[model samples]
Target: MTLLACVALISAAISFSSIAEPLTSAQQNQVRELIRDTLVNNPQILEEAVNAWEQRSTEQAGARLGKIIEQNKDALFNNAASPRIGAKNAKLTLVSFTDYNCPYCKQFDPRLEQIVKKYPDVAIVLKLLPFRGETSQSSAQYALTLWQQQPDRFLALHQRLMSKKGNHTKGSIVSALKSTGNDNLSIDKKTLDEVRSSLRLADLLGVQGTPATLIGDQMIPGAVSYDVLEQVVKAQLARTSS
Candidate 1:
């Protein structure tokens, strides 16, 4: 039952109790019958109540997450260790937690590229979360190390990796690295630490899987459509500009 409907029923019972002594079995049955009759005659009440509850719940969750994001702004948006793309001095920034082995993240890569192209003033910080397995971990470490050592070639390699059809193996990662002229790269201890930091940050932000994107205070989970991403970017731009 919806909270509103439950509240209404509880209030009716409370009123009945207050009007006299504790209700007998017969009076309790009467209250139950009354509620059933009301529901039967006005089923729309249930739907309306459910809709209201859902809206309120969504707003509450958003507000709670907004506060959390506000508290961790630096770690999320300005971490120097995180590799960034798009405008260097962007008016708005998006923090993306992604896994190379995740098919969804692969699906999201093209749309992300489009966003970068379409919105020159927006930046995206990439945090590689190796949630899938050892191959995922190795890939993330390689990407991070590459970004640190050779920033200019990182995007090309990233696009190559994300564009791959299935789970990345050691051979595939090396092949992609070679294709992007980053074949000599090696993962270091610092890169592994950065990968761990990314995982911890994802845990802090309640990320359950790949492709969790943070735009402003909202965290969009999974691979959203280009239109949805564009709409959010526009909305955030408007809000920040104002």
Candidate 2:
């Protein structure tokens, strides 16, 4: 038997013994000696065992995440308070948790636009997570306010904000607001609550950083390439259609 298989059998035996009669001191020593000799002879078993454990852990994590997504589907996808783009009733939907001041989110902005243009049946729900600091918080509040008061102008403001690089200043934010004819916008209680809600959702999803994209059962972190984004979208579409 392979060393890994032997290790599994040893673990099973120990569990069985615990439920019945515990292993005697001599039997425990024998098991330990067997493992020691196996490892000494075939050191690669350690690497194989580690890889197997990691794969199982990853699969378990993915399954847990999928369950969470399923439970919160309405909040993630159909929230009227969230800013959204692309088809209204899409066959495939993507949820993105982003910070306006996050450079990676800025970098990923155009790629999202490209996806919208290319796939008419796809929709993107934008959750404004402003965990970067004050600048991020301000932008998120403003964006949410615009989405609440003037939905038509929200996309223009959103694209303009995402197009900007680095930290946003008061002046830069005001300029973008004015350009979108929303310079008079002010953060209201509702907007603040919405931003807070997004933050909580991000935390629940285990999103540690900005530019986290959710497609189907997977939550992909970082600014993935357009090709990768498209591939995931297509795969999701296929699954849904199947």
RMSD of each: 2.5, 2.6
TM-score of each: 0.92, 0.89
Residue-level lDDT of model 1, residues 1-242, one tens digit each, is 55477677779789879987999899889878877877788788788888988999999988988887888888888888789999999999999999899999999978888898999999999999988888899888888888888888889989988988889998999999899888888886698778877888888888998899999878899999999999999999999899
Whole-model Cα lDDT of every candidate shown, in order: 0.88, 0.88
Candidate 1 steric clashes: 0
Instruction: Residues 111-201, candidate 2: write the lDDT tens digits.
Output: 9879988999999999998878888889888998888888888999999998887889888899999998887889866777778778888
- Error of model 2, residue 160, in angstroms: 1.0
Estimate the TM-score for candidate 1: 0.92
TM-score of 2: 0.89
Candidate 1 C-alpha error for residue 165, in Å:
1.4
